[model samples]
Target: MRAFRVLSHAVLAVTALLAAAVPASAKGEDGAPTEAGTTFRTATAVKQGQKATASASAGDYLYWQFPAGAGQRPTATATVNLADVSARHGAATWRLDVFDGLRRRQPCASGEPEKKAGQQDSSVTLTCTLRTVRPWAERWSDDPLPGAYYLRLTVADGPEEDLGLPVRAEVEATAGDAGGAHAGGGELGAPLHAGAVAEPKDGWTGGWWSDRWLWTGGGALLAALAGIGGYTLTRHPHRFRSRPGAG
Candidate 1:
């Protein structure tokens, strides 16, 4: 009976530990905006390298905003997963456009401005990298704008038959050093809709602290300690009866 009780407690502890270690969902972590204005307003709060995923149909506009710190260049990559029904129509072409906070189109230094998914293919990917160009005035003007930048993904040209097919979209962004002192600083653009801002997790930088392995190890250690403590407390206590004549 004692052994059974110990075993039950051990199982419960393990189960609780595993439950606590599960990570939160990656999709919609940053509350991906469905429009341009909302995305521009919330882009500065999104951590670099955090990917956002969402489902949409053809003609639907998906937006992701990111901040390009002063002296930093921003780059974005998007991957689209098409439903099986999408192939029945024909080849589909997608467009990716980069815009500044003011909605002005910005040019990329590399990467295709458009991508196509063949009838036999189920996925397509596109990438864009933007650098700050020095304007003619003052020998240095941040043409790309260091504040908020947006990436707009849409079905520029696709078959009408697959217009309603579902698409799984994922976007990720990063910023690289531009070899100068950081200077640009400004407030985020006003949101066009209510509750457009998303508060990022505290101390989250998409860095070592967010690693899942570290959390898993910590949980395992706590579980082991709980198991040991349970076993010790459940064991029968030592007892002795004093002799009638003994002092």
Candidate 2:
């Protein structure tokens, strides 16, 4: 009986560890590390519900990734160096999002995340604060679902320079869950290829700007021609007069 009791206790401990392994976000000591590091990038000038671009007027973005069914969350801390602030630039804000492959999940509130092992729901943890030296350090966390996940970062408008903002994201996770393996495969949450435009903002593009310029230039040229014709007719009365005065 004692031997059976010992085995049961061991099983319970292992279960408890596994239960806590998956988190919305976790620290380095708690998660797993991959040989292939996980990370992504974006612009600080990114606005809500808008795609990011590497435009001078825009800012910078950074993201982190985790493998599907790894049985752990991906979290990281990075340093952000801000410089060349613009008068129009607003406060530098940091954000986090979870993605199955490339499809981002909606922000989950406390105690309302997807189920993992023993927990009824998962969780998301984030910490953002400012630092001196024009550079800030940010730490992020997320309790990920049993599929591929990504952590995304954004700044309203970043500093000025190539590699303008020094942003680095480190990842950690815990692995091993036979149930997760049966839940689904890695293909479920696949990342989209480059050049995949999810959606555009305000229904405008570079082509639209070019067309506007063409129309404006054409209109100005037509107006100038009309004005010249009117002036000539008014200044030279004989030009339009009947030559012999018979008609």
Candidate 3:
């Protein structure tokens, strides 16, 4: 009985520790982290066909990072939910710029244009698309490179004080069936970027793995099960013993 009680207490303590270590969801400004190599804050990862939300004021610059596979093209669309005070500032123009992993501005094949937010408009959407990711070679020149890409959003005209507006960003990457003839080399052989492999700080790196609550919960459950199994096997050792020489 004493052994059982001690084992139960150990399991409970370990479970509690695991639960405490799990990170919680961040809210408001806390959810965003400062982008590496830049002062802009980064929100949660905007997966393909999924939307991620962030808050920013007028004239505030926002940045987001997304991954692109070789022979794949990525498209990002951002919609700004302006506050009521934004209407007083008249029409507002917003710009979305796409950059490669090296922070070099890459030209978009389509959807790279300034969007105007009128006084009556409650929201404005801007989209930017990049060509297929390809290697740099003599055959294919000046093409957009693959790997990680960054999108920068800025409001050119708006009320300066009207900050804290909500913005939704949606990103999508489409992969081709096979490599094109003109697509210089093969897939991206090198690493995506230095930032891609960096460990996330406070679960707010804005990558797909930022949300670790599910993983941690699963781990805790597994640990509890293992502990129970160990205790049962040890406590019931006689059950496994051959009884009366019966096989």
Candidate 4:
């Protein structure tokens, strides 16, 4: 019965991990965003395949929010269309930054996060491809977890004349196959995200630690010891008839 119980637990752990690995659903409003938010709190929400457009000054910061689930890789692209290129005196630089639900800046594995636009250029484009989102992550890890993500687009640098220039911006966030990269273990009870109000600490349902890992490690140690003992008992014994050799 003890062995059966252990087997059952191992199966359960594997099942949960496999279930979490399943492809994230493509479920969200299909409508495109009509506008973008200036701050994280007011960030416009967008869905996959939906293009978000906003009209803002060149130096203004635009924010957009999107949902990402485990096993999905998120990529966001932004384009700033210079309505009046002739009004610019020098080149301008644009940047695209991605953040997680915790407001932590996520490192981009690829995509030109920052791009420069020449004086005569009509538009500047920037994009960022992030790591695969995980089902659960260690408290100390900054790994991407399933939850809300935010993208910020802004003109990093440009001439003073281009500061207030009217610009049309478009942003699109899409999820791609993770290609089985950055594999991690474990699962979470819920999708953790940032909240304005702090809930009671005791309100959480799950414990902070995982006993599954501890149990598995202990089982492995016992199995190794048992194997060694069995080998000693099963192998032919060497009868040593040692004579006193005092030279």
lDDT of each: 0.63, 0.34, 0.58, 0.77
Q: TM-score order of candidates, best first? A: 4, 3, 1, 2
lDDT score for residue 197 of model 3: 24
Off by over 4 Å in 1: 1-45, 85-87, 133-142, 181-247
Looking at model 1, how many pairs of residues clash?
A: 0
**Backbone Cα, N, C clashes tallied per candidate:** 0, 20, 1, 0
Candidates in order, TM-scores: namely: 0.55, 0.27, 0.56, 0.65
lDDT of 1 at 60: 75
Report the lDDT tens digits of candidate 1 across residue range 1-247: 9999999999999999999898554335356432232244433234467777767777677777665543456788888888795345888898888886567788898887698888888789998988642211131433664345677888888788888788888777777654423223342243212122232222111112323455678889999999987777677333244667989
Better-scoring candidate (lDDT), 2 or 3: 3
The most accurate candidate by lDDT is: 4
Candidate 3 — which residues are off by over 4 angstroms?
1-24, 27-44, 85-87, 136-142, 159-182, 186-188, 192-194, 197-247
lDDT of 4 by residue, 1-247 (tens): 9999999999999999999998554233655665778999978877665788888898988998887766667899998899576688899889999999889999998899999899989998898999887778789999888777899999898888779889988898887655433435677676677333222121222223344556768899999999987787678344333456934
lDDT of 3 by residue, 48-123 (tens): 4434555556666767666665545567777777767433557778888877666778777788447988878877
Task: Quantify how close model 2 is to the true structure by its C-alpha RMSD in Å.
Answer: 21.5
Q: Estimate the lDDT of model 2.
A: 0.34
- Candidate 4 ranges with C-alpha deviation above 4 Å: 1-30, 180-183, 194-247
Residue 58 alpha-carbon offset, candidate 3, angstroms: 1.7
Q: TM-score for model 4?
A: 0.65
By summed lDDT, the worst window of 10 consecutive residues in model 1 runs over 199-208
* Ranking of all candidate structures by their lDDT, best first: 4, 1, 3, 2
